[model samples]
Target: MTQVNKALTAFQVPIIDVTTDEAIFEGEGWDAVVVIATSLAEIKQDEVSLLAAHASQIDFRVGKSATLLFAPGLAGGRLIISPVTDSDNEYSDVRIFAKAAREGIAIAKAAGATKPLLVVPSVTDNRFANAEQVAALACGQELWQPLEARESKSLQPSLTAIGLLNTATHSLLLNAAESGRVLARDLCGTEPERMSAIGFAQYCVDAFADSGLAVSVVDQVEQLKAQYPLLSAVGRSSFDVARHHPRVVKLEYVGEGPITKTLFFAGKGVVYDTGGADIKVAGSMAGMSRDKGGAAAVAGLMKALSILKPKGIKVIAELGLVRNSIGSDAFVTDEIITSHAGVRVRIGNTDAEGRLVLADLLSHLRLQAQTAVNPQLFSVATLTGHVVRAYGGYPALVENSAAKKQGVAATLAEVGQLWGEPFEVSRLRPEDFDKIADKNGAADVVSSNNGPSSITARGHQYPAAFLIKASGLTETELAFTHIDIAGSAVEGDPLYGKPTASPLVALLQFSN
Candidate 1:
């Protein structure tokens, strides 16, 4: 059998490794050079010493200063000096290093350097050493080329760490960045078919083919109708309107030994959500392509884990790939549908299709866990705009157990401080579940209640409750957490309000 390569060829961070003895400035062909200093003495002795002629031109006292100087005799080459404080020595504090790297890359780009060099003087400190590579990866942001056939103008820069370079640390940083690059490309790229439900499943299957993962894809509605009616209903709507089919992609990673715990991750993969028969306004449907951010994240996590090969814990991912488009065949408001878990659901609004897809996927996962020894569930989705309104640019986390919730919250908080991807914890109250109950003898429960009495502002919780019920697990029986990444998945910037592929760093850190 021919093996499929899951490795990404586009949007990769090009890293050039250099030994300590190599003089970074020896090459006359270089466009620019970046020198990072930890102390004032190092700023004067180590960094500034290389450019003694222009030492007097720069004020080296300020921390985090990026000074661009021209070398007169060296054919007008540019040199950038960035300073760091002693307090920023915490290796665990990724922000300090990432910030310094971002500054270095910005300065290099401004100097018109297609291939600049980064030099960190104090490499004995692991933080400084890691910072060099972090800067190189951050420089990737400048060199990033989206999925376009057009030629890219981005540059691939090199770096040199003065102290002993930890090869393992360098590999880890590069791997993490590579994983992130795949996500960014998937989220930000403009491939409508590739981002579609069926296309996304194909992407996952190709990606994990050679990664030792067991992949299964259910693409037709007929195959899923009896077992996953909710998912089938949502996906069938897009068949006539968008000519897109839905699919459920499952990936499993099992270790050699007796697996003690199984981790199941479900991502809502509504490739293009047009709010079905209810329909979304122009503004609401403008960026509907990003509705698959949750599945993109899951694919990214599985990619990283496949490379990292974490032991003992088996990982399973269920990506529910479907499109909710409006047409005569689309599921509409006030329609009743029986889910795979045997729960009768009334479609209060067709826009609430993400939870419906997840409901069936989670139900399947619950059944899988019955045979497995110990199982923990996690669901990620861009469920509602209410979460974006409440948290602005942060993900809302809802966990069944308070203790487990606090632990994950604390871990995520620490990771957030370092990575700048914060998540807020939302309560999964009993009233939330009570509201989803068959109130008017209409159905087992309403899929969504966007009416006046409905808790629309706290809409993130309602879906969480509905999913828990769909999973066929009591809140106390299984450990489950829901992550609503509606706001954090995309950038808030006006000009580039694109998908950011967030929480990848946080999730990777938590898994570690």
Candidate 2:
């Protein structure tokens, strides 16, 4: 991420011809400025070390040519095209390939030419069309990242477009992604001491404010109790023990003039889950800081929605902001808790706290949406290992309503294509997913019929459908699509060497 001005030229990297054995000279200049290369062939690692050294110095001289300003290497069969439109061709602006195209734009523009040009070798289809995205890699580079770990982490791909039109579009997409990542940095760095429930809520509130979205925070135990009981209940115990207060966070993004269609999103924002009375073992609680991943994703999605400003869609979101820790007044197992929508739930295990938070928030969203035009509400969470184990971490689990004849399936397919991950949507017929301990104590209507009995009984897909339905929504019309990002929420890639941006792609797909 150095310098990408706008859409200019392209460096076509495909084999000159599929059948031809001929190739361009390694490090051959793509244009008067940019150099196309994979390696120097003669020297190993030397070129990479040199490039890394020259990455910072604006005055460093790699060549005697006046046009040469910055240097970036190329890959196989692909020659970096310079001056994308005039002498070269730009690649597709697809988000998946954006990392590649953006990198290319940055280096080419850095060339010393007064009006230095950047090029992408080939032209791509509409699937890759994003102007701001190109500019992000080309122009914003470091501005996008606000985390220690991701500061110098070179993301993959480069962007190259042709005129101002291409440049603008690429630049916008890049900024949107950067803006989202800055939110991610806040999410990724959640440590218990500094990143308490209140701190995390402040981070979310600030993000929405920066994005021009409206937000409200209910801070203090009494305020939290009067507003959000579930959030208050879980954290109240901890606050009394440590003398730290709790808060209830809500964000609303009003789109267009007078909302026409509305969608409600809810998340379990447990900044830290210590299992309260039912404690988690050392290893189980290791990554508890990431327990609030669902909250972070929801906040990120809200920011993306505000920036994109899709004219027709308006969204109302609720986050169950709290920390689940052990204390004298901690919520104990088997305790009957009343949710925002008045649904009575029996706490089977205190460790399964994400659902408790989600249950209350989900029920509340349904009620809120009922007052709007065509309520299309959904909930996302890192809830339940049953769905995770069912999908095997690669697939994203959505309820039967999601895969219905509606466009949800197609939209999901389009988004998942960006990162190339599997999405196995779990299908549900009825209340069959409810975990049944025995026919004796459980209510017959709520209990599952002869289904498999495992701790995996209540998966995110079916239970979400049921929870919303309990709020009086029909399976077909309610538009309840629950996404459990247990495994897919965070992705592990060798190329990235850490988790890449996932829920951003997922969230954009639905909201857009």
Candidate 3:
């Protein structure tokens, strides 16, 4: 692999190490210079004296809102002056500054500059450092340009901190950027086959083979069918050896000594959803390749855990890898399929295949928790369009424990604020399950209801309710939370809708 490929696959950000002693305009020239200021007045002073020298040559003005100024810097280099705060606030928030810095990088890239210098005028506090680091990472992401057949170049840029730059803060920025790069690549890639169920599983195995992670693969249809009928049922349609078979990938991260608490993470890995036998319309299935976003997120979280390696907590990530394709043997609606939990499920809509796969895997996790100590189960998936309609790019969080709901909500909010991955808390009412019970009177559970309307109208609560029941988790034994990232899985844009790879930072923060 080339250097660019290595940097991308290994999740390393393109950053060049630098010392504080280096002059801003010395040695090799830079393509652009990013100047961060609080106000235009601040820029006229000694804080940005370097840029102030050429302020008259280039029209520079300050405003109430964050703005960017483009001009010529020393030695024909471009200068980008970005303000983080307006007149109302003294210091801009980390997010605001980070965004401004990102915009600065975008402007520089648009102006045909590859090597840009980032200069923050603020005192290096925790907030300032965070914003600066986020800016650096965002800049690196903007610089990264990948191609399928041709060799790509690495995005290596130098960062200079005017004030004291802590070593720990720098390291944190580098780590976060690396993780973000992994997520961006997965979300932004255009290749569908590379992210297929089997293909993804192999990728995971390759990623963690030497990372001290115990990886297991279950690909044979018969073997999966014998163990997890629901998972096998959803994946049985595309069983061709040449076309890529359905599979389940399990990653276990056991800390030192006996496991005291087990955190189970199950993700829906429907590589491409043709809605099975139900068959989705043209536009509905346009980005169906992103169906495996849930699994991708789980994989991203696993990658973070491998590096962080928090002590005492054992993490098990189960990815339900499958392709919900339509074929002669595809599982259809109204079929009575028995789940691994032994609950008889009458499929109401084959389109609701994510829940079916998650149901079996969650049930298996519940069974494993029986012997484990302090087990907590958390499942992530883009299970419903209703969630997307309701939350619109923010994950919908549903937890079984009503009492701990507030705490969970606060934690999620904190993580969101810290990392920009926000989620809303949604309730799972009893009536949701009652409707499912009414539909499948003969069976223990109904995979879905009469139509998409019933599922969407209820805000996708039915699936969560069914999953709880299928997982064999009693209301009283509340230790589970379901994150519905249906709407939030991939960012909607005119170009390819990129996967957000959300809640990865949240999980990492919570684990720590």
Candidate 4:
């Protein structure tokens, strides 16, 4: 057996270990300089202005694409200018800077520069307050390679460190967030075998060791089956295989100051979703490993919280990690099962397993919220294809009545837009509850419609209804939100794309 390499459990992305400098040319030992701006003419820095002036005279692409120019006077005899487009419009937000910064960093890496200084022009506009930080994070996003690629190829970090020019002291925060995102990408984008349920739990345990967050992993078959019946049902077929058994990782963070807000998160960590008895056909299961993205993001969020140690807030997360494998013991459709909350649920479709896993976890969180301070509940999952059909590359938030009244989704959507992770606010209506109603009247609710969520009407929206009912929070006053990241968890190809760590940044910013 090839010895497995242990993952770097901390902030290991060297490129994101950022530094801030007031000037671009002062001998910070930077190899190359990459300037990202909406309008080059507005920048007041003398050295950047001189480089842009010279570059504009020689190449027309200076302010258009990532244009690299040779200069003898600059830090590394090279200058890369990237432009942010359409940032002045009503719909445009701070992501323009991120997009341009990614392009600039890519060009710098391709140019063989190990230490590039990023010059992001800070804007006074309220909308772009965090533009500099967003751009820096974008560079991290662009430079990050997949965990498998790094482990198999024995890849080393290409860029040593990044310098942030004319920006606030955000290195600590940016590095923390990027570190969380890196952990998220690694967990969400890895192969099923590498990130099996037990493996995932072990990773979290190792990552959070001595981080001050109380972490516990529950792997006992009897304990899991009793505490998380719905989640256990999804993993029943895989239980016989010791390496494939399910796990529930519980994480809690308490700030030093008096608690002002309490947050409870339930993450659906389906390590591999073969779709159970209702299996996905025609290569649909190729990227089923990414089904654990929600749990991965939550784990990453806890990591950031542990590092930052923000005050006055308490966070608790339960990640239900399981593999929806198929076998004689696999739970099938039409089977009636009682949830942890004591609500009877009929398996409308075995493929709709994420919600079942989340329902039980959410039920547990709901119980914790009863005594929490100003509590808010959220269940995150890549649960349905209907979200992708509805909003391409954007996560959707479905809030119950209590959360809607509190503008929970609206606030998250606003924060997400500015941080390069956008969200679409979806409403839960009477029709949604109706859709999940068990027609047979044999159970309290149905997991999902038998048809594909991409074709079913209100497919993504109705799952929140089932979650609310099955979790025993149907008429509760607690603020509860159901986040469906089916569309935004991965970028590009559905099977082989990079995990974007959707809503992590948004949720992090909103929590702050």
Candidate 5:
């Protein structure tokens, strides 16, 4: 293993604050000091000021509770964190754990602490006291925040539950989130060759199996063509690196139980968008490599679901993975590409390839919703600049129904500043869709006129909103909201206050 891994493995963790006396002591291989936050010692008056008083300090608080674990001589450093909850407490929706997890994790990451200690405040049982390193830990679901696009596990006496925020448990969750993030970053930030469609698909499949979820992948282009025509069309015209083999990747994660809900998650997996034959200016395409951030988000979310095994929730995330490279074999302008929904799209601009990829994926969701599950599903993607511009670095909204609108608003509110303000809803119908609906042609409105319109607040953002509705979703209460993360998905976001993937926050907000 690596050096960091070795150090964490060897390090002894201490869990304090368990007794009525509240004493400071050193045990064999572990040292600790327990203070009573519920008693006289609790930092009550001007607690934030008191914690800030210490030169080299560490302090944390959730709601009315406040805690400080500090040392005078440690100098300046970073903080690492862990989140813990109990099995019985998992369904409670208590504020303490979630608040603690989000706050603790953020502080730890921001401080750059080598190892974080999320001391779950509990008295019944000890989960992390003996757990070892992993992503995150849950005792009774006190604070079970799943960044599915970024999920978790436990450490200390590894695999056990944590009723209290145990140091070792926090370490494990910290490790897991960090490791998962690296994997996610690798999937997006690195060269596509290393994280190919097949390799990535296999990893996701393995994760599902390990977590007791059934996984299925359709890698052969012929199979994908037969079942998912839209995926094939967008991909058949594209190539993956050194091979001419037509690209097509499909994945499904099946959870246990009666499958109460089938949450259809789709992503625009354009591995690399070279603007095709139309090409793109260097400045306008600096980070085109991150075109696959949507897919990465989907992959990360799938990984988390597999690992956590959140019961009673059935989810299927679909990704349209392909590289829109510039070549003679490429599907250029003036090509009418039929969607999985069977709607014909005249390619407007190859730079607008994100739309084509999304068209197929959205069509798939529409087909599934129209044919199968009860019409209760949500589809997310890094689809448009219009949504991003409308939301403008805050939580934007484009709800198709009252349920989604209320659920999303309430969930975000509970997180307490975790997500930004949402954008207003923009309608998508056959009339508006037909106006800019050509595959071989660029949506002139989006290309030529982008400003505050009958729709969003400001900017040229028509393509995604217009075409997404064209998929099988009906004109009635069958709601649909398209998220265009043209400038939204990233590690460093000014509004979120740290390097983040945005989807996690969106998921939490949506779940509420």
Candidate 6:
């Protein structure tokens, strides 16, 4: 076990709005100026061009990557020029700006500057309409220190505030979204004991304090077992330990105006997945602590929506936080368990516990959708490795029949692409349903096949089918989307990489 220090606050970073070019040098206490653009020649702002030209003259790396130059006239006498490369390439997207902004912010932080003014010139390209916001968020993504690092004082907080220069996007909104991302990353990236099922719920409760959202944590043993049976079965072994008991954190937000659209989300928060009876052998379980990315991301969405307070939209979320530990009480393969929806599920593999957790949560959301106004339901989870194999570093959306009919997945994919959080739309096939059907009709559905999802055919798509059946969602035509964030949840090294908070921005933009 490691010594854990918890953060006292949820969001500590502040975003300041810089509306004029003069502010780059003299206004709002900015210490360093960071200009990120596709090309330096495209920059028409006189003040920005002055610094850009100066850096280009002294260093050849000016337009290639993140370049820092000594400028006496600028704030703190420091200027950093970050260029977005490969924008003109046939397959490039707006993520180039995100990559450059991260690099620029990194250099600024290393240079001992506390406040950096981020300048992103407006582009006529509709594809990059949200470039300014994306770059601003990229900076937050880069500067975010893990919860443990901050609590233990191993890594000190760097930036006091970030200046978004001459932009149309509101600073408050960017900060709101970044705040949620920070919360999401903290919840997803922490170690198992530090952010166990109970710890995760408490963090959310604290984060939502005075935020005008209805928050409740369901940890009563009998209550959770009655309401989330499938989820309980996953956490069965850990029930003996008070800290590791399963929790279903329920949250709701109703806007000021008449509700036109209602969104319900189910998040899979498997705090640590030891794979149960089908234990992850060899080195496969090193990064299992991050299995809760889905639940973390959904919580983040609600946090952002609470701050933005977009009218005519109502949001409800349920996070299934549990640990699948290997012990005497652990649920094993081929065991039959009834879900909260009363569907009989035969556990085919204990490692496939994330879907079980989601199924019960989605079942609850399905019931709520029955009486809601224009409801859209979604399940977000790091449910399978096949998604990573199918689409590397991109979340995949698998929509039910009703969602496909309404073009829900297509809409999210388009919005995500423009916002630099790209998604792959996966279809639900009849074969997927067939894969979950019990060969002997012994149970309503089989949880999963015995093989690892990364090696199984249609590994990622079939779970959506099982979720639909087990959750009894087929009883209605409500639009439901299962988002698989297995690959996109973390970047670079899967074991130690930073949580990317994928699909959070895309979902927020779509909700707005």
lDDT of 6 at 228: 91
Candidate 1 per-residue C-alpha lDDT over 1-512 given as tens digits, one digit per residue, 9 for 90 to 100: 22213235433544555454233343544456566656435543343455633464465433447667765433126666665545444434444555566676677666676566565555555334345555555555445444433224442222221121223345554555555556544643445565677667766777666778888998656788888899888977676644488888898887667777787889888888788877777575777777888888877777777777766778888988888877778877788898888888888878888999998988888788767767778888888778877777779888776426446556666665555456788877888888788778878788888552124756787788888876565534667788898887766452235455666766766665
Count of clashing pairs, candidate 2: 56
Question: Which stretches of model 2 miss by more than 4 angstroms?
Answer: 1-168, 241-244, 392-395, 400-405, 418-422, 431-462, 469-477, 493-501
Q: What are the per-residue Cα lDDT tens digits for candidate 2 across 1-512?
A: 11111100011111111111111213332232223222222112344335434632443332211122333343221222212221123432234234433444444444322121223322334443332233233332322332433324643223222222122224344345545544653564446556677677766765565556778877756666755665566775777744246655677777776666787877767777777778876556766666666777777677667766766777888877677888788887666555555544555566667766765676667667767786666666666556666665544546446435566655675665443333566655555444422234432113122222124454545555545533434433556666776665554431122333346545665565
Each prediction's TM-score against the native? 0.82, 0.67, 0.83, 0.96, 0.63, 0.97
lDDT of 3: 0.66
Q: By the TM-score metric, which is better: model 5 or model 6?
A: 6
In model 1, the Cα lDDT at residue 308 comes to 73
How accurate locally, in lDDT, is each candidate?
Answer: 0.67, 0.51, 0.66, 0.87, 0.44, 0.89
In angstroms, how far off is 235's CA in candidate 6? Answer: 1.2
Q: Model 4: runs farther than 4 Å from truth?
A: 1-6, 9-11, 14-23
lDDT winner between 1 and 6, please give it.
Answer: 6
Cα lDDT tens digits for candidate 6, 451-503 = 99999999999999999999999888999999999999999899879998888
The TM-score-based order of candidates, best leading, equals: 6, 4, 3, 1, 2, 5
Query: How well does model 4 score by local distance difference test?
Result: 0.87
Model 5 agreement with the true structure over 387-424: per-residue lDDT tens digits: 55556553343444443644643443344232331234
Poorest 10 consecutive residues of model 4 by lDDT? Answer: 1-10
- Superposed model 3: Cα runs more than 4 Å off: 1-12, 15-25, 28-32, 36-76, 85-95, 111-115, 119-130, 140-168, 180-184, 187-190, 240-242, 255-261, 402-406, 453-455, 475-478
lDDT of 2: 0.51
